[model samples]
Target: MEDALWAQLQNTGLEEHDDKDRIEAESDDEEVDVQEELSVPHEERLQGPQTGPKGVKADHEYHQQKKLVTESKARAEYNARLLAKAPMTTTYLQDEANKDREELLILQAEEEEEDDLKYYREKRLRELKNMSRQQRVFGTLTTITADEYADEIDEEMGDIPVLVHLFDESIPTCKLLDEHLRGLSNKYSLAKFIRVSALQLEFDLVESPAILVYKNGILIANLVRIIDEVSTRFDIDEIEDVLTRHGALSENDLYDLPTNYA
Candidate 1:
């Protein structure tokens, strides 16, 4: 009986030893498999499961979600930068709108100012034309008698200047003065010019060629023996110089003369 028990015990110990060796071998194999899997590239490992339809769909979904997360992060960063640059979007937009409105108003004001200048320019031209037409109406010499002097010369002469030539038609100097007076009347249309016989004015025949200047119904100048007052012989220029010196003609009057007159 002792010999049989000893054999059974020896057999059981051998079987346990075999079972431990097998378990150890299997654990070593599993460790080698884990090491090989770790050695493979990460992309190849992912591709292994992605070869199947369900694995491929799961992989696509995972990449899609990752891409969405990355894009969302980038969008958030961009928005943060924009906010740092300009925190008040409404105020910034309002300022830009106000600047545009101001520029428009300034442009409109400039246009209005230009229009006003044009209008005034046209009005001034019309007034000048009307004045020029009025000046041309009285461009001739008139003959008057002593009886008509008050009505024609005195009362008729308001602020305008009047030139009266007292002469005898037979006098040589008187005839010369009459010719000059005719030309000056056309030249200086603003001044009234008239001729009367010296005898009609009760003046001496020796003073036949006399000149009288009147303004505002008052006799301002009386030049008797006109040849002696200027020279023995005088031209239109000398007569004009004398009249200008006496304030009968002014620079403004000369400037306002008709352009058609020489």
Candidate 2:
């Protein structure tokens, strides 16, 4: 009986060993089959994008737009830490505030300079542009029929030109002279443009349109019928030419020419 029991025990041990070996062999086969079926071909993977949704872009461009947002979040956290009133943060905040103040002052100064330029340009444009018939017909010309109360010509500030046009007749030529003088008033804001009749003049004048230019209370030129000689249809340029030639005025320097008594 003892021998039979021992024989049974030995057979059972042998059977257990065979079972273990079979299981291990089956597991190896399954592992091989899984690897063969689940893997992609190397060539197929090479044909597509390298990795992720990035589509093979440079490392720098990856999450580039989001970098700003993340950086902003980090800055906000840093600012919060600084405002928490630690000693180092207090020093950093004070320095940052001083830097910000300096930047603000620089920006303010630049803006003021820009505003000055803008004002100068606008003023120049208003003086030069859109000078048509209506605008040309009437301007800042001072009219003196006889001897009015008083004019600013006597108290002439600087070497500003005092142009007195003697046009008494109500004829077409006198009217044209009036139009020309009116246009000049707009162009030459620094100079005084005056229109006086024969009744106002001390000297006896025969011609209709006579112009007398004075500077610093001194006589410059007494022009007679020069407009009638220049052209029948006298425009602004011809008159400007005459004035520039006579040294009464030249091209307007806008801001450069000191108001000279403005």
Candidate 3:
């Protein structure tokens, strides 16, 4: 009986020792598997959690959506900054346009002022020249002797019409003619008038108050015994008509006279 009991105890001890060795071997194998898993790269480790193709596709889609959301947020921030500066940019452009328009208006005004000044300056110059020309022309009748006839009537005539009256101072008709001629000289300033003694030219007293007209140093008309050729008692109008008919005087000649004279 004692040997049987001892044999049973020895068998139980051996079985316990074999069980401990088997447990130790299984624990060492699990430790080697964990070390190999840790030694793999990080990418393989990340893929290790995926069960199949569906999980891998789902993960790829998740990362793609995340990237799209990040890009959308960056675009929204850029648009927000641009919108904030829009008002200032529009205002700056409008101000530049207004400044350019004002400068153009100022330039146009200056050009108009310059044109007005030029117009008035030219008008004043024309008026001055007309005044100077009037001052140089003869405005009244002048007396001349027989010796001065060539110098007074011919040499100084130029393109002007010259009227010479050969008169006897003693005759009443001749004296009347001189008064009319003096008035005519002041009225028709463009024409030259002069008188000389009839006796100086050895003319008869019966043919006294003879009239002669000259133009450009050429004798154009001669009237002897003028009181008989025209009306017996003629006024200034009849004499002026006779001179105008003979081409010695013209209506156009009155334009050179002053406006107040007429």
lDDT winner between 2 and 3, please give it: 3
Model 3 weakest 10-residue run by lDDT: 253-262
Ranking by lDDT: 1, 3, 2
**Deviation in Å, model 1, residue 204 alpha carbon:** 1.5
User: What local distance difference test score does each model get?
Assistant: 0.76, 0.66, 0.76
Task: Say which prediction, candidate 1 or candidate 2, comes out ahead on lDDT.
Answer: 1
Error of 3 at 202 (Å): 2.1
Give the candidate order by descending TM-score. 3, 1, 2
Report how far residue 143 has shifted in candidate 3, in Å: 0.6
Model 1, range 1-262, lDDT digits (tens) per residue? 9999999999999999999999999999878877776787876654444333345686786577667768999999999999888855558789999899999999999999999998987776676568766653355779988998877775554567888888898788898888888877777767788888888888886844888888888888878766875775689888887888877776544433344333
lDDT of 3: 0.76
lDDT (tens digit, per residue) of candidate 3 on 1-262: 9999999999999999999999999999878876776676755644434333347775776567667768999999999999998876767789999899999999999999999998887776576457547543455677888789888875654557888888997888898888887777767777788888888878786845888889888888777676865687667877787778888777644524444331
Candidate 1 local distance difference test against the native: 0.76
Point to the candidate with the largest lDDT. Answer: 1
Span of ten consecutive residues with least summed lDDT in model 1: 253-262
